[model samples]
Target: MIAADSVTVYRGLEIGAAKPSAAERARVPHHLLDVADPAHAFTAGDFTRLARPLVEGLQAEGKVPILCGGSGFYLRALLRGMASGEENQVEAAAIKASLEARGAAEGFAGMYAELVRQDQGSVSTVHPNDHYRIVRALQAMALHGRPWSELNKEARATPPAFPGLRFFSLEVEKEELKEYSRWLSGDQVQLTIHLDKEAFISLSELRAIRSRTPGTKTFGGLIASLIELGMEEWSLSNRTATSLPKPQRDKNFSL
Candidate 1:
């Protein structure tokens, strides 16, 4: 709602989406949330396309663009720049609108069926609620005899334009961050934990302190220990605390 230097995709989504509440909506203007019906799916690339301009325009006006969302991948793509080829606003809008109307009339399932028949590639991963995208897939199939998914895949395969961009993850500590599981959706928590150490924490503990305390580091000591040991066993102190904690303890020692 309040489009500034960066765009804030609304928070507090319900029904499996984190959307901003009504009170929250009045507090600030938001751009994307409940933009798609629950049945519809929105892709990172699509979001990147819509948000990039919002971000750039905000900067152009000397406003700071903030891309805020639970969808870290979406935020990353927008900031890093998703490859959408060159923008053809007229064509893009028309294409998007036409697809929405057509999908509405044809019914989402029918459209998805047609998409699968024509472009299995897109159907495999595209969600049903994502009517806009399903329609787009069908449109691409009619035009190119291939799924629009191919372009998306190609885009992902290509590296981000602004490779130098630094993505900072707000980290939380293990024992401290253990409370997030309750408030966070399973997928959100899973995403936060994936490839990170906190994933090992019991869901109950994670639920207890998630909001109160964040993990000290994104990952856990286990992987770090493995990395340091490098396939050779070392005199690991108190395996859990011995590896890294000992050094910190030593640093803190001395009268």
Candidate 2:
């Protein structure tokens, strides 16, 4: 399993971040934990770059790699790859400084208005008070001659790193599940299961069953429940206790 978390990514933050205990780690091998120093800034891009290879390696070995954590942006970056451009850091910094100066002189409201003019779609995504992103978006528009939102849309159109991905969100409230469903609408997931609190299964038990079953098809009632929950593609099982077909090495697993 790989963690897509920011708080737990840093070293020496166990208690503060409420990381899994050592006993839990002993039960399942976890990756990307305690990888960065507290002083180092670990961005979503950095997490995606590091995790992609690890997930691929596990898949190559015919092992399912579960991704866990609460860092939505990092998870999105890992799943949908980032926009590619050769950044001119010096020019970007200059532009950022100029925008900051403009904000200081003309007021933040004016700078925000400029951002809205550049890409109205970004208004909902970015907080109105977020000066850093406001400057960065304007800088991107200045450098690329396109809005940051447009760049993001183009990046999302790129082929996904992992196809045939299934997402299972366990023990989520109905409201949160609805929100997650909306957020993941464009992901093209093969299946998305949202289990209620009553149906919650212990992670250790679930892992044990998966390890023992290998590719054993059909979780009888589980499949039924999924179907009832509006998954029409799932059909009744035909295969016996046989190994599941090994997924392509390039695919990723998430939970």
After superposition, the stretches of candidate 2 with alpha carbons farther than 4 Å from their true spots are: 84-111, 129-139, 171-255
lDDT of 1 by residue, 185-243 (tens): 34543554343433334333322112112331222333355456864544444464654
For candidate 2, the per-residue lDDT at 216 reads 13
Cα error of candidate 2 at position 4, Å: 0.8
Question: Model 1 scores what on Cα lDDT?
Answer: 0.50
- Candidate 2 Cα lDDT to native: 0.66
lDDT of 2 at 175: 100
Q: What are the lDDT scores of the predictions, listed in order? A: 0.50, 0.66
lDDT of 2 by residue, 192-221 (tens): 233233123332223212211212112324
User: TM-score of every model?
Assistant: 0.41, 0.55
Question: Looking at candidate 2, what is the lDDT of residue 57?
Answer: 97
- What TM-score number comes out for model 1? 0.41
Q: After superposition, how far is residue 183 of candidate 2 from its true place, in Å?
A: 28
